[model samples]
Target chain A: MRDQNRQFRLAKRPEGKPDHDTFDLVETDVPDPGPGEALVRTRYLSVDPYMRGRMSAGESYADPWEVGDPLRGGVVGEVVESNGAGFEAGDIVTGDLQWADYATAPGTALRAVDPDLGPVSTALGVLGMPGRTAYFGVREVAEPGPSDTFVVTGAAGAVGSVAGQIASLAGARVVGFAGSAEKVAFLEDELGFDAGIDYSATDDYGAALDEAAPDGVDAYFDNVGGPITDAVFDRLNVDARVAVCGQISLYNATERPTGPRKLPGLVSKRARVEGFLVGDFAPRFEAATERLAEWVASGDLQYRETVTEGLESAPDAFLGLFEGENVGKQLVRVSEPDE
Target chain B: MRDQNRQFRLAKRPEGKPDHDTFDLVETDVPDPGPGEALVRTRYLSVDPYMRGRMSAGESYADPWEVGDPLRGGVVGEVVESNGAGFEAGDIVTGDLQWADYATAPGTALRAVDPDLGPVSTALGVLGMPGRTAYFGVREVAEPGPSDTFVVTGAAGAVGSVAGQIASLAGARVVGFAGSAEKVAFLEDELGFDAGIDYSATDDYGAALDEAAPDGVDAYFDNVGGPITDAVFDRLNVDARVAVCGQISLYNATERPTGPRKLPGLVSKRARVEGFLVGDFAPRFEAATERLAEWVASGDLQYRETVTEGLESAPDAFLGLFEGENVGKQLVRVSEPDE
Candidate 1:
């Protein structure tokens, strides 16, 4: 009960790729819960591409992470102590529990993580925030249908991987963009992408996209919006929709860099490109989580977790998302099996 | 039996700005109508900006004009004779008729022009296709409400003038961009535009747009897709919708020119910029035209026509749209107008 809590605090902002100096592992006391609060022992800490934006001192669509503060993200954990009436001890939960060994919330931040559906770790991947993101970005923005050819960028990662499968399930002809031949093959062979284009292999990305989507693309799920996006813009059908979920490729630039050839393609194609935050649809969380769990259980939806063991390994796992290291959902498994 | 026919033909294609050499007028014998055809005496002719695209050789969104051929456009006229059973002589009609004093068309193409709607020539401008184009571009594409701040480019031309007014009527605070001070004032004074920006005045177009629309633009009705539009693009609000109705500024452009440097702003703001041709909404013409007529009759809408008298002057009227010569709708009163 008196185990020391190890916390990774931000040391300095990274210029491009984060180094070990950017993070500090410090020992902190496990504090008691006050009125209407609960202490949580994190089971899994989710590492996402969006976390890269928070590291910058510059303006982001979301708030920037302050230096010297603990890095925070969505985590699936167990509540060890509670003063809130509804959520008691031993309940599995998911919320914005920071990158420390344990966290305390006002019970308002944490939600019950359903264990029967699949794994509790899925709360950080398919059946939680990322799932809600895929839903809103696809259903609300892209609105892919059976006749539509849906194209997804960053198709091997947490959100993009889920978005591609969901579009396919909605009867769309889905094509994915991944970094390597292996990931491209994985997307097509295992994940059921209609086609896959390895962006890292080709200089003529436009032609590669053309080959993959022989028919014109109706909607584009743009997780990476640079040249990959400009190429996709050129291939868009009339009245296309682009859901801009992230721009990971540009997030860590040391300076404001020049981007790919764009605009004329955007206007000529008559497309709609919109940016969104998952928090915009927070009201629909319960309904979305329920449906996401059902799909995962029925095997209609697929999810995978790239788990890094131990709380001390959390920083490297997060930095790995920027380098495209993880295969699917990246999470740090914080604690060993409970007796 | 002896009413001779005459047609003004497109003798040569214009390089940049079309000149008088591009046209050739001649008298020819009238051809007899076959089954499903009727003889239409051209009374009023339409000379629109889009007609410029038709004059080119190839690779346009619209069909090109044939060499040494009598040009055809939206015409309001009288049915002189008919091989088709549906029409009778002296029935006033409007349709795609040749740029001539006398022309023939399928009876199906001819709609009996309502003479009682103010002046019959109104059929060529505010009461017809041009009017419907403004309607759909503003309502369906921009969809600006009272709370919206609307910005328009080429804001004193046929479609642009109507678009600004419609946006104002929708309770939007309207700002217009015009080539001259006179046209700018006209948009502000007569059309109820809150402000008018003379784009020719300075290089600070984005600043000018910002000055005109302090709250930032909610909807942009873009007819000119060059720098003027780029200026408007720089001032869009979050989730803003831009209806790219026409790209007249780029029509005769020798090379693809770029400026108005604020595209990436669209991503963060989640704005939508899309190109549209009025032909895409041809199916809804009847509904759109009827509403436009009612709006015009009730004085809720206003129209202006830069009429060039006689069929011989149609070329000058057509070329004037590009030079910013016309204040609003440009038309050629091809005959006595059947008065």
Candidate 2:
């Protein structure tokens, strides 16, 4: 076991986009597991867009990480030392853990991940929180029907990619809006999406969306909210459903930004907009995981990871999310799991 | 019977607020009813905020009124002449009719008003579209819990007034925001609302809303959408439900107005916002009306009307809706019913 542990702690609350100054890396002794806890050796640390929300000093569903506290998010690690029952050494697990080489968590909080079910890192991506978010948002919130047109923003991101794939599998014509031509090509060429629009290249987003979704949008999975979302609202068909999964576009705004008033459009379309978190579906997590695993195994669903090589690169990896630098799930590899 | 009928025709679509130039008063010969039709003497003409949407050439759930077309709205009239089944002179009936002293409509489009239950004019007010709107909004969309703090904007207007009353009777603590001090008093003192804020008297709507709903808002019934809506979005509690019933505040804007982006609030609260029209509830109208009538009879759902006395005052009555002139349901009393 490594005697020294590397940790990234929140140093300051960012007013807008976070910089290197927002986080501080410190070296400390590896944490020892207390009673009913297990010491996990980190393999991969998940960097997500929602983590930006926690970096700000405000109300969020997830508790804000105060300055001097270690940043916490989805982490897949191996149980190297155990002081609790049912958790044996060498067992792979995932949980909301500190960004450290070693994290000690209550045994009850960590869920075991089977290595045979693809790479265990997937427990942090697909077959995990992002997967469940896409599953529930598409099925429960959006409820896309066969022949319906499903439009997803942030189409190449972790959650948006999974959401688009699921909607396509449900027999809906899927149209996606991504940042680049490459991401757009990935959505249409690899994911069976009916069409993909490079939102960054378009000035008239509504017209672009209208051309892509000629029948109008029946279900919208919004991960990036801004002009793209505004355009989607204008083209919503009657009884449309919008799942407000993320608003990465407006997360860094120093003050409230305004767009075209959308309630009027909602009334005309008789639409519904709902925002949700994966934790809201805790009871059905196992069921969702099983279905997601089946899809991954059957080659029906595919995922990519933009991996940063070291613990020191975590800040750059996270910041890259805002710049649209990463494709699919972004992760920081802290160490390799023991066989 | 008068041979000449006074009609208001759409002369031009107004740029902002409609004026005399937008409406042209015309004199026409009263037409006889054809088969399955009835010629009725107009009694009360309903002037509502939604009519403003129809005046514009755009997409709305309600079809837009074209130039040279007579203004049509919900009207309660006495059947003076009939050419259909269940024909009877002096029968009070209600249907969507033109802004004229006398009009002809298919008998099937008109429903006989049972005066014994309540005022026949209620077929256009509390027991009609607005009431049904409030009913479904609270029960179907907002779904307020007995102990929840239910906040409603435009609380003194037609739909908001009834929405507040219904939420209050459902055992929710109802708080309202209105345009004037008198309307605030009308909501709290006369209508059984738990609290009321005169939005016109306060610049900080969020502060006023917070003071009234100290426990945080569980359900918000939005009618006049704008900054008031922006304020409510800031304080939404977990699983909050918002029923988007109207955007009367922005109805007169020549251009699409931009306000604060609100999807982030929904994410933190796991909230829902849905838009609906009463026409969507046609299949359940009978059940809703019966329940509403019982509430009215029991004094649990009292209503008030702001009546303009002449047919010539119809356009002024509608324009007054934008100015927040009418306290409750605004109507034009074209003529009196024969007792």
Candidate 3:
């Protein structure tokens, strides 16, 4: 066992885009598991866009991470030691944990990861929170019917990719907006999306949509909000549904960004725009996970990952999301799991 | 009966706010009723905000009124003659009719006005399109619960006044934004709204909302969208719902207006913003109108109207909606009902 554990702490709140100064890495003694707790050795650290909200002092769905406190996020780890907890040593688990090499968590908070389903790192990605988010968002919020045009922004990212594929599987014509030609190819070629637009390559998204989504957008899963959203609002068909999953583009803004008023357009279309959080569907998570696992195993739903080498790369990995650097799930490999 | 009917025709599409130049008063012979048609003498003509959309060449929910075509709107009138139609002569009815002293429409298009319900003018006011808009918007869309802070803009206008009253009746604590101190009193004293803010009297709407909706807004019904909507978006609580019924404030803008992007705030609040047209609920409008009539008959729902004297005043009555000159449903009393 390692004698010391390394953890990342919030150094300060970011004004706009976070920089290296926003995080502080510190070495500490390996945490001991308390009664009904297990010491976990983190193998893969998930660097998600939602974590950006925690870096700010403002109110959000998730509580803000205070400065000087250990940063926390989704982690796939192996149980190092169990102190009267249900799990045994060497068991793979996933839960919300500290951004550290070793940390302690209550047994009830952790779920065992099945390696046979896929790579255990998927416990932090495809078969996890992002997958559930996409599952519910497509089926429940933005319910794209057969022959409906489903348009998704940030289409090559973990959640957006999954969301687009899910909508396609539901028999909807899927159109995606990704950052690059390569990512757009992945969406159209690999994921069976009907069409893919490299949003970064075009200035007029409305014109692109005119060619790609000629029927107009019936169901929209928005991850990157800004000009893309404005363009989507313009093309919304009557009775259209928009699921607001994330606004990664506006997350780092120092001041509130303004755009053409959308509510007026909504009245003409009778469209519905709703924002949702995955945690709100906790009771249905297990069933959603099973369905997602089946899709992953059947090769029906494909995914990708941009894994950085060490825990030190976590902040850079996270910041890459806002820059559209990562193709899919962004993760930091802290250490290898014991056989 | 008048042999010559004076009708208002669209002269040309207005650049911004329509004026006398937008309408050309012309005299025409009263048309004879055809098969399944009835000739009706217009009594009260409804001058609504939505008409502005029809005046433009741009696409909207309603078809644009072409230049040189007679302007049409909701009108309550006394049937002069029937040709194989359901109504008898002198029977009061309401339907979309031209801005003339007399017009002919198919029997299927006209609904008999039960004079015993209230004043016949109400067929175009409280018991008409605006009232039904408020009904579905409040009961189905906004859906305020007991103790919920329900905020509404244009609270003294046609749809908004009824919306606040209905929400208040549903047990929500209602806060209203009106244009004048008298309108504020009308909302608070006569209508039973918990609080009312004279929006024209205050430069800071956020501060006004802070005082009126101290618990934060749970449900919002927006009628006059613009800066007031921006302020309401700022004070939304978790799980808020915004029903976009109208954007009268933006109807006159020559250019598409821009405001703070609201989708990001929606994510944190897990909120919903939906825009709707009353016509979308056509299948259920009868039931809704019946319920609204019951509320009115029971004195649970109170309504007021600002009536202009003649057909010549129709254009002025509609232009007044943009200026916030009318306290309630603005209408033009073309003539009195036949004895």
DockQ leader: 3
Q: What's the distance in Å from true for residue B251, model 2?
A: 0.4
Task: Give a tens-digit lDDT track for model 3, residues A1-339.
Answer: 788999999999999999899999999999899999999999999999999999998888899999999999999999999998899999999999999999999999999998998999888888999999999999999999997999999999999999999998999999999999999999989999999999989999999999999999999999999999999999999999999999999999999899999999999999999999998899999999999999998999999999998889999998899899998788899998642
Supply the TM-score for candidate 1.
0.89
State the weakest 10-residue window (summed lDDT) of model 3 chain B: B330-339
Please report, as a residue range, the 10-residue window in candidate 2 chain B with the lowest summed lDDT: B81-90
Question: Chain A TM-scores, one per candidate?
Answer: 0.96, 0.98, 0.99
RMSD of 2: 1.3
Compared with the true structure, what per-residue lDDT tens digits does model 2 show for residues A213-306?
9999999999999889988988899999999999999999998888888888888788999998888899999999999999999989988888
Worst 10 residues of 1 chain A by lDDT: A259-268
Q: What fraction of the correct interface contacts does each predicted structure contain?
A: 0.26, 0.88, 0.91
Interface RMSD of each: 3.8, 0.8, 0.6
Runs of candidate 2 exceeding 4 Å displacement = none
Task: Estimate the TM-score of every prediction.
Answer: 0.89, 0.98, 0.99
**Model 3: lDDT of residue B320:** 86
TM-score of chain B of each: 0.94, 0.98, 0.99
Q: Identify the superior model by DockQ, candidate 1 or candidate 3.
A: 3
- Scored against the native two-chain complex, candidate 2 gets a DockQ of 0.86
Model 2: clashing residue pairs? none
Model 1: per-residue lDDT, tens digit, B120-186?
8788778787777788889988989999999888889888888888888899998888998998889
